[model samples]
Target: ARRRLYPKPFPGIPYNKVSANRIAGDLPELIPVIKATNEYSTSMFAISTQRLRLPLAQDPREIEDILVRRGREFDRAPMSIKTLKNFFPYSFMGKYNTPEVKEQKRIWADAFGADFLRKVAAPSIYNATLDLADGRPFEVVEDLHNATLDAIWVALVGEEAGITRHEIKKFLQSQRDASDGGRRDPGPPPRGYLLRREVDYVSEMIAKNSSSGIPVLAQKLAAYLPRHRQFRRTVDTEIGLVMRKAVDRFQRLELGRLEAGENDTCMMDLVLRRKVLEAKKLGRPLMDPTKDKVLLDDTFLMMFASYPTAQTELRAALKVAFPHPTTPSVDELLGADIPYLDAACEESLRLAGVAKGNLRQTVVDTHIMGHFVPKGAEIFMNYHVDHAPYPVDEEKRSASSQAAGAKLAAREGISRGDVSRDLGSFEPRRWLVKDEKTGQEVFDAYALPQLAFGGGYRGCSGRKLAVMEFRTVVALLVLNLEFLELPEEMKTLKASETIFRLPDMPFASLRAL
Candidate 1:
């Protein structure tokens, strides 16, 4: 057990394997443990057994030390590789530290760079905004997912890649359905009708495993049972077909550009051009087959990881920004300094972290937070643990007008923010501060430690792109509509189907301003 191997020298959650397993689902049960270790115990602690030794790093500085300052001494954790490979067949998410991963990072940097934003992403987003403004009951969730889909297609393959086909669209939706936190209606998959049984099982596997990390041994152990072995055998084939189709489509689109002798301003053009330049430098005909795999996987994962997170964040922003009904022009959106909106986005990310934390494997006997972590120790940056807002005491809550007065006014048949009546998630004042010297308002950014996007060189290169999309679309939505809260029973959209803290968006209907 963890307590036995870790010794008494370092403090941690009292490791009971039964309790540890239960903590996987019992969120209420887990928070106090996280709160205690981070706020009450040491900066970092361990949960170790003979098979696994995980250092739960809660100090932002210690997390920064692992992710940013000392990133070179770590690699993508084995847990990520073991769990995510099926979905990320050709991407960096599941890859370890290697020359190839470093090279892939470069390609991703160039592919998702600013030019890609201006030429490919922004225009698509602006157009989606315009389309979304057509006065229909938009399922804010699904529409956002589709818009990101279209944007990624444009960025990666060029709009000319001809994704307008129904089959391809269905394929995209299939991926979306599988990751939407549950099973689809029992029926045929979008494609591969004959393999419906296998495809459904694969979808189940992806939907089940997408949000959590399953240790490789645990996965193998599951296969030794009956139903899981069927899943193991069929999942590879079903998922393989999807991967092959994706790779084939990418190859086709790139080859078409080659045959036409014309290049569109998209990621494919940039990537292929980089490949050509590299091949010439190396005096070879083309890039390595492996490098090509990077481009294929990178583009897909780029879309998948982002689209859902963007939609969830938009819902979060709407929870705050949609009440104002101030539609900024796209140009105004791009130009003006809307620090409050930016603050709301940051707050949403902090409150509903897209990922619980990131994983890193120690590459050597390393000194992290003054403790020597043995080589091969896996480090988990528990962002929830880190971002657990230092609690506000009941006395403090009762004293503040923001908390107590709102509750008291509702019971007394008085309006919370006066009878003028507008709906927003929480008072925006809680997030703002006036800068005396600059005479401008800015977010109280460090009110909490935010690790929504992980830190370091390994941090998301797509951060800029994702932020732009969030700012542009949510800003536009605020311009075009007003957000009203659902019924008291349907007050929040946050879901429990997964650990990723995404929203169910229940009864989250919108109204035209």
Candidate 2:
């Protein structure tokens, strides 16, 4: 059995090794492992000490076959839930499997329905992109990240949170610290600190205005303050308080709008409606603003989750994918197909696997791929490992070759495989195909790839919104300015494993066309 599983000594090197007693860690670069696992099963691997597991699938079909068809059989693997607990203690309130989580998911999912998504999200994204590209050589990651944050905030909250690069950087630092059990140097001040400060600033403004009997004037003044130092105190305290107040204010505003028959189509408004409708459907009383902090938590959590991931991914994508000197301009990208951009974003996500590894604790003794997985065993699926290369049909190979050729041509004097192999390697076009006879297009023609949002009944509820945001950001970047690689000396940016793969530092430089 050992010989069968360890046949021929796996050739690909492991990405990260920590004393032989632990699970061998794989990095994004180890695509071959993912490819091999997708193609064949090997029981020699043990994800945890007590249970031996099989190789993962690389193609989407196999992923779907397992996740979709037999989803109940497999469960979400355990991951570091500590960070989530610390940051969002109130929502799931640190409980992973709770009624609150289910309720929050249901409310958020309902709020992001199709019509609300297209109208509110799409235009907001377009405008935000244009605003970011208003004649600046801004770092693509920073700019793109801010754009996504602003767009999501506007869509969901009917207001912008005034996101800034420094604030985002600090927020990311806090999340990273939380993930490592608060171990690493406590990098930069906690972002919660900054949010608390902002809340104080707004509250003071509101208080001052209230005394003057002019609430509107105070709001206008607070809105005008710069994002940085807008609040004079810590972010957590200040922002938390303000959000509490805003939730109340928005609820009342929504009521007035409804009374007046106003169709204010924003995320906050949509969620407010859903909450009421759901309350009625379940035969429960309407959400009490004062008691049930669920709505407030849901509103803020959505903003928080949506912002950092989008920012981190956007930055990582630009840092790795853009060619130096003469990258594809943002304007050129905007005109491209939404699906193609979506594919690029998906490819980036697969390569990065932002959430890193997912963990599951066994509920009952079960066998997976001929290996015994004992009850209570902890299992992990390294998403990065599941994204390796596998057998590709003629069409896929051709598309990959074309994308490679295009990169080579763009480099002009550089060696064929230098930049092409290390960074800027993935080609979105590799995922597309055109019919030879009629020249019609085919979407995801390759066998099912391991790129679904996730698996099971718990699959991503906000997939539609996420796709729209990704497509909009990519298109805007492609259209506004070309994505160029920074000079060789400045090209050593690394992905920091925070809540997502954020740049270790601001991406070197992005030149505007």
Best by lDDT: 1
| Candidate 1 local lDDT, residue 348 | 58
Whole-model Cα lDDT per candidate? 0.53, 0.47
lDDT of 1 at 475: 68
lDDT of 1 by residue, 1-513 (tens): 644433222233333344334324223343455444322112223332211235666555346546655766888888768766754556887788778788888876766777667756676666655555544455555555455555555555454222223333454566778899654443333332323343334334544543223435554454456765564444444334444443344444444454342443566556665555455556777544334555555655665566445333444444454344455455556766656777666655655555666678888776554456678877777654322322333333212223433443445321122311121233344445566667666666443344667877778777877777777766666655656666777766344323244455534567775
Task: Provide TM-scores for the models.
Answer: 0.64, 0.59
The number of clashing residue pairs in each candidate reads 2, 47
Residue range 177-288, candidate 2, lDDT tens digits: 8888674443454343344343334334433442332334544554545652333223344334544554454445444454432454566666665555455556787655
User: What TM-score should be assigned to candidate 2?
Assistant: 0.59
List clashing residue pairs in candidate 1.
Answer: 2-48, 327-479
